[model samples]
Target: MTAKFHAFLQNGTWELVPYDASMNVVGSKWVFKIKRHLDGSIDRYKARLVSQGFTQVPGVDFTKTFSPVVKPATVCTILALVVSCGWDIWQLDVHNTFLNGFIAETIFVHQPKGFEDNNYLHHCKPSLFIYSREKITIYVHVYVDDILITGSSSAHVSHLISNLSQTFDLKDLGPLHYFLGIEFHRDAFELILSQRKYILDHLLKINLAAAKPVSSSMATSFQLSRFTREPLSDSTQYRSIVGALQYVTLARPDVAFAVNKVCQFLQSPTDEHWGAVKRNLRYLKGTIDSGLIFSAHSSDTLIAYFDADWASFPNDRRSTGGYGIFLGSHLTLWRAKKQPTIAWSSIEDEFRALANTTTELL
Candidate 1:
């Protein structure tokens, strides 16, 4: 670890100095992990020095923090495009991506322990990549230390990694297989996306592996209303249900509407709501193998569908609006939301729903 820090310093990755007249330095720590192969063999020892980014203030430490990731729909569309056009699909990963992103704010960080220069113990300067190259169309999807770097060419991707590795101690993971719990499988004909392992693990964790599955997410008789005969005594169960359902939506858009409906009652749930939540879980049991499968046969054309249930809630009289966007045969994006304003007519409600969907589409 000391040797790695010395290499980082020699490469001009960061310069340690006294805290200057700039933003406060966030604290940092070393994280160590052991990499293991699928066969359970020891792969390598990994070490990371990371900033405590949670301490960063929203506007002060960072503004416009929204970094667009390749959405599920986008992923499907890209895969479909690869299939249709027969474009070679390759996945590349970056090592220590956050270290490459240049900080716009004059943020400082504490000198890493044990490797701190005695003469420069007070502060450390930022050496992020974004700070140095403003014009490059370099976008990175970061999940802590792991990163997925997508580019138009393998050479471009290689160049970016080469440049980055020059500055930081980096290990290249050739192609992406598992990212953010989603598993990827690629072949000459198709690129498959699934979370079968994740789903099974989740079900086992919630003690629902043996539960009976249902045909649909909710029953036709099920109606969620704001008014309830009795309030739920345990709120933790309600939150747990919501969290589980949220993860279920990764591959199961069918449950999205039902989950969204139940989520609306999170603040004040009732016995009826709890029953509905259980019903959704039971539905998951039957459809455990169900997930979004993005085939390479999909097209590039984009189409969207929108619908609404006006005044569906008896308590609030709020309408529920839902929209789904498709690229070719693959569904890329869908959203279920409640309308902000009450409408007197179905036409008015539908029109408002269209407006909302348009905003999202734009």
Candidate 2:
């Protein structure tokens, strides 16, 4: 807690101010989190001073909200390039990231409970920035404070890190073994990206870790419908699990279709929908180690394959379709989603999926 408070001081996150009865005072609290490694081991314990931004009056206190996030496809593409080129990849983490943002809004907040400085005061503020070198080329992908850096030259990469550390509080986490919940396992010929630990953690969280593994993500006979069975008494757990499964699709495209099917009924989930979700989980249990493998011998050619299921959803006549885009031999992008509008024929649905894939490729 003291370290977090000191970060606020060093970053000039807020200045001490006198308490005023008329000021819109936002409550502040300490958020504690245990940082863990990819193997589920404790990396460190972290605490951050956070403001209860929820209590603020929206229009008055904040006019716009923006989140600068790197696209997943972009990250995958870069990683694939790095693996194929046999480049050096490194992960970096910024300390006290949120404290570095400069907020223009005049905000008031109560002091942190234990580390209250001068009674009551309020302040607040909150990277997608990249740096590159000359002909050797370096790529830096930033998602908030977490960074993934790679370059063709090892010495150049080290020099870049040294330069970055001088300006920012940086943690050079060696080679990019893990970042953003995905684990990268690399050998001489290939790099395998997997979320085995994430999958196991989710299974344990939902108490399905002991369930028998299944061969398929979704059973052929498992057709879910909102009215097929009684609605869940409380839909919170159903929504929460389905939402969590969405993240799994990041590394597990094999379950993307199954997850997309279950996600359709988030609003009014039934026992049948929950059963399908459990089946997907069981399938993931069996294939927890599966992931996208980027091999070094990949070609530069881009290939795309798309297919459609005409009017597959019983609830809606909309067609279900998906596309897989491969660069050389490695799959770079894939998506399983329902069409926005119902197609008149199978060919029309197929064409829709093809058009979508072509758009993505372009």
Task: Output the number of the TM-score-best candidate.
Answer: 2
What are the per-residue Cα lDDT tens digits for candidate 2 across 1-362? 77767766786777776666677888888889899987678998988777898988888888887777777777878878887898989999987666344568778877778876443434322133444546677777778779888878888879888998887779889898988889899999999989888888889988999999999998787677767989889999999889889988888889889999999998989888889999999999999999989999988788999999999988788999999988888888899999999999999999999999999998
Clashing pairs in 1: 25-108, 73-332, 100-129, 101-128, 102-128, 102-129, 102-130, 213-286
State the C-alpha lDDT per candidate.
Answer: 0.69, 0.84
Give per-residue lDDT, candidate 2, residue 289: 91
RMSD of each: 5.3, 2.7
User: Estimated TM-score per prediction?
Assistant: 0.75, 0.89
Q: Candidate 1: misplaced stretches above 4 Å?
A: 1-14, 19-25, 29-64, 99-104, 112-176, 226-241, 268-275
Q: Once model 2 is optimally superposed onto the true structure by TM-score, how far is the C-alpha of residue 320 displaced, in angstroms?
A: 2.2
